[model samples]
Target: MDFNMIAARGLVLLGCGKMGSAMLGGWLRQGLAPGAVWVLDPHPSDWLVAQGVHLNADLPARPAVVLIAVKPQMMGAALPTLAAMGGGDTLFITVAAGTTIATYERILGAATPVVRAMPNTPAAIGKGITAICGNAAAGAGDLDTAEGLLAVLGQVVRLEGEHQMDAVTALSGSGPGYVFHLIEALAAAGQAEGLPADMAMTLAKATVAGAGALAEVADEPPAKLRENVTSPGGTTQAGLKVLMDPDTGFAPLLRRAVKAAADRGRELGQ
Candidate 1:
């Protein structure tokens, strides 16, 4: 797709923190016009300046899309700047976790088309999964606009209902931390098995990274894939047995953790 064409429409990113900067980098790397982006960050980074992007504390006139990437706590304070730009044609896409469309309506009026998204940290590499849900005021074209722009970051999935966003946040939004912890655990286990610290870390990191890559391209079910590498009387199976045993398996714990995160997401949205 021609990302440059889309970028020409003028997009304002309201934050330049990690996630926001990642999205900006992805768009620019994919041929987005530097002039089309206006980044609003109190403390602008050197990289942003090098790319010839506009970094200002003041909000500009209504752009086609005003992406709200501020922290949830700072989102309320950021709304007043958007007040001058909230109208029929303009769209507000928020990446702030837990804040709802109702929250946007409260500040920008009910008629403003607002889209809420839960994006993972992997977007820093343009390989993230972003789940988005827009308010009723957003028409088909508006939704398409939001989706197309976010697609620059990674895959885009539109939810049937906004309620599912809590679950999405719990899963993908917090999923990276869980995976990172698993990597740490695997490395620790390797070290416990008499391996050198550096070697164990490398093995754990490569193993997890390779597994993720394989799973992405695999046609078979994950369970079947797991079985494929596990021999009946092998070291792999021995490890699998420990992980698969129902009494103290990893599933139950992970399920509880995800549920807890989902619950917390709901509470935050409240």
Candidate 2:
């Protein structure tokens, strides 16, 4: 939350899409000066233009930080623009999935302090959790700076090493999509059991949301929470019987899913 260094030295943002806009909004709300921020985007949104930031203009010779939020496909073209700012004290933080620290070091210089982060879609609402890892050029203070900025979106965690990033990408990065699909499937099952379509969807959404909130605040682990909810001979137990089956349950299925996603992440990084 300390804006002393960044406010004086300035910060440059490479892309201003949904995730970028969300972070920019949080920063501005948390007292970061508008004049200290510069945004570069091919198609600037009306809201972005109204934010009073230096849009598509010249960048500061040495910014405190440069956040790269462009998609992976757009990164090749978008990154070179800031190559001039590399190989110095300026820190670069990237949220683009599948882009590795080595790639940035290759484009920028190896001396560039690059921090790679993976944040999910929930960041749009300030509820996402991001995992970050920095290259050798980034010092302890640099990691602290990156974590401080990223905390505006939600919780920020540090990886032991870059190798763990692929698993993190599989678990939390893509987990939101799996949760969304569960809502859809739950609603369909409710409809199959004779509930009205609208009512089924409403119930499904509320149940998932409520459970997640409970899990967040509860002291007990998730397994204990599940045990607390289901009585021995109740309908919940009957449902759990099918869902907990070792061969064909959520456990094995999700393992395969996460493995597939992690494998793909490794491939993309390569």
Each model's lDDT: 0.85, 0.95
Model 1 has an lDDT value of 0.85
Candidate 2 per-residue C-alpha lDDT over 44-122 given as tens digits, one digit per residue, 9 for 90 to 100:
9999999999999999999999999998999989988899999999999999999999999998999999999999889
RMSD of each: 1.8, 0.7
Off by over 4 Å in 1: 1-9, 57-60
Q: What is the model-wide C-alpha lDDT for candidate 2? A: 0.95
TM-scores of all models?
0.93, 0.99
Q: Report the poorest 10 consecutive residues by lDDT, candidate 2.
A: 75-84
Runs off by more than 4 Å, candidate 2:
none
175-206, model 1: which lDDT tens digit per residue? Answer: 99999999999999989989998999999999
Highest-lDDT candidate: 2
